[model samples]
Target: MWTTLFLSYSPIPEYEYVENSIPTFVAIGGFPFIAFHYPSPPMGSDVVSQSMWPLFYLNEFFWLIIGTILTKLLPQKIKNYSQIRLFCIVMTLIISLSGLGYLVLRFD
Candidate 1:
């Protein structure tokens, strides 16, 4: 899930430049799933600095692996994943509703 460099920055923030993606949702696991396109890529020399990124799909992939292992290890505690799945579905619905509103209001 990606967009065509659709967002602007806070140095001159505006309403129309907002962009989002699902990898962000899986990565961050919260409200306001923003798509962050840096003006330039982080160099290898800046190791610590790179970790501060708002978006990290690689992190999300590893997290998913860990989460799956954990879920398997704690199936009974999580109610066989049903409860968590329900919660995620509900949150997705809420976010989608808000995003629809955002697009409607953002565009003419």
Candidate 2:
């Protein structure tokens, strides 16, 4: 949720056209997935071409709902299994490390 909020507010330049073309602002939500582009109008132009990616928001909402449902429905025995806990921890570490690596490479 915090990531989504931050990404929505802080868009990074992802692509640029020719010298005269407008630059595209891209924001990635939901961690490493779901990116949307916001195109701004060129200077001194009244016409604005902007769009919102509903799926970007929808995807997060969908996951939230699904996660809530699964948490409520799944048995405690399965949720509390040692192997499951270990797998979740490992996966979280891998994802975090990969994301950190990407950020370091990108910003460096």
Candidate 3:
């Protein structure tokens, strides 16, 4: 989605200082599952912005609502399909593991 794309490419002012210094993975989905380094504020800078923190939780709630509505709207037949379930499980694992791998390699 647009949010993931924007977060990946756009320069968020709060993150500007540590952008290139850290590795970030914005998972592919309607809601971003972010895995990234949390950099401390630069030395001697006392202003630690908490603005982005609330947005992360807000985004999760928004997507939860959307997902609930979608599940209700979707037909049971489609939801019950083995292929769909398998695909979802596989994709989730792949994305989650990829993010984990990136973090591990980054720290190592």
Candidate 4:
């Protein structure tokens, strides 16, 4: 995830030039998820800066690890494995719903 994020920020002049214009959501999909639901449309920089960004990155890192381990380390017979899979599915649904809610609720 970090690699992808960093690569996304790679010092390509075109990327930088493109990043300079448009709403934050136009630069990346994530903000649109929030701004779409937010009561007020998002303004200002869309770039994820600040110490919290590392935390967000780390959170995604851990989720990736968890997903990998769940798929690779678990045996098929474990009853809880099904539950875990369900939980993951539910998590994806909930996240998408939230994004959709953001999009639907925002005035824009």
Best by lDDT: 2
Q: TM-score for each prediction?
A: 0.31, 0.37, 0.41, 0.30
- What tens-digit string does per-residue lDDT give for candidate 1 at 8-69? 22222333344552221111121123333222222222222343345445434554676689
Error of 1 at 44 (Å): 42
Clash count, predicted structure 4: 2
lDDT, candidate 3, 1-108, per-residue tens = 234423553233544446566424222222354423333323212322354445546656776688799999977765458888899899878876775454334334
Model 3, runs deviating above 4 Å? 1-8, 12-54, 99-108
Residue by residue across 1-108, what tens digits does model 4's lDDT show? 333332232222345445446433333322111111112145533333453345445646675887798879766676677788899799888876774454343325
Q: What is the per-residue lDDT of model 2 for residues 1-108, given as tens digits with 9 covering 90 to 100?
A: 334534554465544345665554333334434443333423323322233336545656776787799899976666558888899799878866775454333223
**What is the clash tally of candidate 1?**
1
- Candidate achieving higher lDDT, 1 or 2: 2
Scored against the true structure, residue 85 in model 3 reaches a CA lDDT of 83
**What CA root-mean-square deviation does each model show from the true structure?**
13.8, 9.8, 8.5, 11.6
TM-score of 3: 0.41
Question: How many clashes does each candidate structure show, in the order listed?
Answer: 1, 0, 0, 2
Sort all candidates by lDDT, best to worst: 2, 3, 4, 1
Candidate lDDT scores, in order, read: 0.40, 0.50, 0.48, 0.44
Worst 10 residues of 1 by lDDT: 22-31
